[model samples]
Target: MLKFTQNKTPKLNFKKALKKPIPVKCVQIDEPFEVETMEGVMKGKAGDWLMIGVNDEKYVCDASIFKKTYELMK
Candidate 1:
């Protein structure tokens, strides 16, 4: 029989957000960035999940969701 286990380790794609993400003054990212994780659906700005604020809020999210959700800022 084959067995499947949850990946406890963070993957490469999970490095989208840094522990200490820098805040940009006038960076406009897309909206409605959402990702389904083991916990639940995570929501944030399209290209700035690690964003500490909406023009300024201190929130936390896993890198996995951040990578999957963040869009490219133009």
Candidate 2:
């Protein structure tokens, strides 16, 4: 049988973890883009950029894009 014992030294430094900053990248959108939606489809206009979500899971797009797409559907 093996017995487990706690180490006298602490495992991690809390100070270092707090000082670290999360990594993120800023992307620029220069042209119109399109996205699919449950209702139908959506679009993004040129000259519009968004502070996208981490790992490209989400993003901010131009308001006009959504408006145009809705109008077209109607």
Candidate 3:
């Protein structure tokens, strides 16, 4: 008798939307934003995304929300 082994597909991890940081002209806060840093809650606006440091720490917010709120920094 011959036996066949079942193939299993790898599971996907969606815990984090953005695994790495991308370049953004800046984060325009139409209203206001409060971001938490390793040190504590740091705030600011304008400049590169990675440099913005808003996403440096773990966050559960959807970036698309910001995309809808803010246009390309240009």
RMSD of each: 12.3, 16.3, 13.7
Error of model 3, residue 59, in angstroms: 12
Q: Which portions of model 3 miss their true places by more than 4 Å? A: 1-26, 45-55, 58-74
Cα deviation at 46, candidate 2, in Å, is 0.4
Top lDDT model: 1
Worst 10 residues of 3 by lDDT: 44-53
lDDT tens digits by residue: candidate 3, 1-74: 85545695346564756445454344434444566656677554433132343455522223565555445534
Candidate 1 structure lDDT: 0.50
| lDDT of candidate 1 over 1-74, digit per residue (tens) | 85545865533465465555443333334565655544566676555444445445444444456567554455
TM-score of each: 0.28, 0.31, 0.25
A best-first ranking of the candidates according to their lDDT comes to 1, 2, 3
lDDT of 2 by residue, 42-62 (tens): 665675544334555444455
In order, what lDDT does every prediction score? 0.50, 0.49, 0.45
